[model samples]
Every structure is written in C-alpha cells, then in structure tokens.
Target: MPQADFYILPSADEDSRYQFLGKLATRAISAGHWLYIHTDSEHLAERISERLWQSSPESFLANSLPTEKLHAPILIGWQPDHIPNTPDMLVNLSTIFPSQTVEFSRIAEIVIQSDEILALTRGRFKEYQGAGIQPRMHDMRKRSS
Candidate 1:
C-alpha cells in the first residue's frame, strides 16, 4: 500500500507550496528516491522546474519535463500519463487525485490554507484511508515558526 503525506501550509499562497516542494524534492532525491511532481498545468510545471534548479546553492535536483529525454532523478509534468513507469515518489500539486495513484510507493500532497484546497485535501485524505492507505499530516505552519 502506498502511503500519503499531507503538508499543510499556513498561507493561502502558491509560493509557500513551491518552496516546500523544493525542499521535499531535495530530501527525497537525497534519500535515493526518484520522484515525479504532478502539477496543475504546464505553466506550473515550468515554474517548478525553474524553482528546483535554484532551490539551494549546494543542493542540486535533476528534473525535466515530459519531452527531450526524461531520465532525471526528478520529473515535473502536468499530466500523470506522461510520467515514467518507475518513479518511487509522487508529489501532487494538483487538486485532483492522480489516476495512477498506486504506481508510486509514496505520495505527497501539498495543501495550502485556502478553503477550496483544504476541502479538496480532506476528501483526498478520506479517499486514501478508504483505499486502506494511512495518510499522515504535517502542519508546516507550526514547523515554520
């Protein structure tokens, strides 16, 4: 069974989500896990790609889009079907649950403080629990302070 992690951010903004994602991706890669970041759109995918590149001065996360040979440790794409067959982790930034939910060993859902996002994430958590997977929640707001 795949485990789900919900990162609850304080602000109702995308910037915090992106920053946390960068940190999470770096940690996942350091732990030797190949990850795929499922974005809400192509523009978001591009933004994540850029953010990952400049995540930190010493840390380096190899990421690529769907095209032009995607053999990197991390991948960023809007469509779930575009992801390769062997990613160990899936970072979901979209509102909808991924179609290929069971394909990855672990999943991360970044949740902001917006009402819509909170509601969607709650549904996703219940869905995961219904599927017999235990979902963990991390309140990033408390950790940030």
Candidate 2:
C-alpha cells in the first residue's frame, strides 16, 4: 500500500509554499527517489519549475516538464492525463485529489494555511483513508517553533 504524507504550512503565501517544496524535492532526490509534482494548471507548473531552478543560491533543484523528451528525477506536470507512472513519489499541488494515488509508492500533499486550502486537504485526507492508506500529518508550523 502507498503511504501519504500531508505537510501543513504555517502561512498561505505562495513563496513559502514553493520554498518548502524545493527543500522537500531536494531531500527526496538526495534519498534517490524520483518525484512527480502535479499541479492544476500549466501556469502553476511553469511557476514551480522556475522556483525549483532558483530555489538555492548554492545549488538548484533539477526538474523537467512532462512534455520534455529527457526527463530529470523530478518532473512537473499540470495536465491530469499525463501523470507519469515511473516516479517513486508524487507531490500533489492540485486542488482535486489524484485518482491514481495508488500508483506511486509515496505521496506528498502540500497544504498552506488558508480556509479554502484546509477544506480541500481535509477532503483529500479522507479520500486517502478511504483508499486504505493512513495518511500522516506533518505540522510544519510546529517544526518551525
């Protein structure tokens, strides 16, 4: 069974969310895990791709879009039809829950502190549970304290 991990951010700022995603992607890649970042739109995917490239001054996180012929360890995709099946982990940044959740060995759901986001994530949490996966919550605010 696949495992789901929900990362709850302290702020609703988009920059903070992307920063956390960069760190998470770096850690995942360092651990030899291939990651696929799923977004809701092409615009968001492009934004994330840009952020990952400019994430660190010392080193940038290498990522590629799904349309690219040569894919890096981390892939960013917005279209629902192009979900890559090869990645070991899935980083969901979309509003809708991914139907192919079980395809990946691990899943990461990033939720920022906001009423709308909180409600969406709550539904996603239940969906994961319904699929027989016990999702773990990581309160990033607590960690920052």
TM-score of each: 0.92, 0.95
Worst 10 residues of 1 by lDDT: 79-88
Model-by-model lDDT, in order?
Answer: 0.85, 0.88
Question: lDDT score of model 2?
Answer: 0.88
Q: 54, model 2: CA deviation in Å?
A: 0.9
Worst 10 residues of 2 by lDDT: 78-87
Error of 2 at 18 (Å): 0.5
Scored against the true structure, residue 52 in model 2 reaches a CA lDDT of 91
- RMSD for each model, in Å, please? 1.5, 1.1
TM-score of 2: 0.95
lDDT of 2 by residue, 7-124 (tens): 9999988788899999999999999999989999988998999999888899998889977786588888987777885648999999987888788999999889889889999999
Question: Which stretches of model 2 miss by more than 4 angstroms?
Answer: none
lDDT of 1 at 4: 88
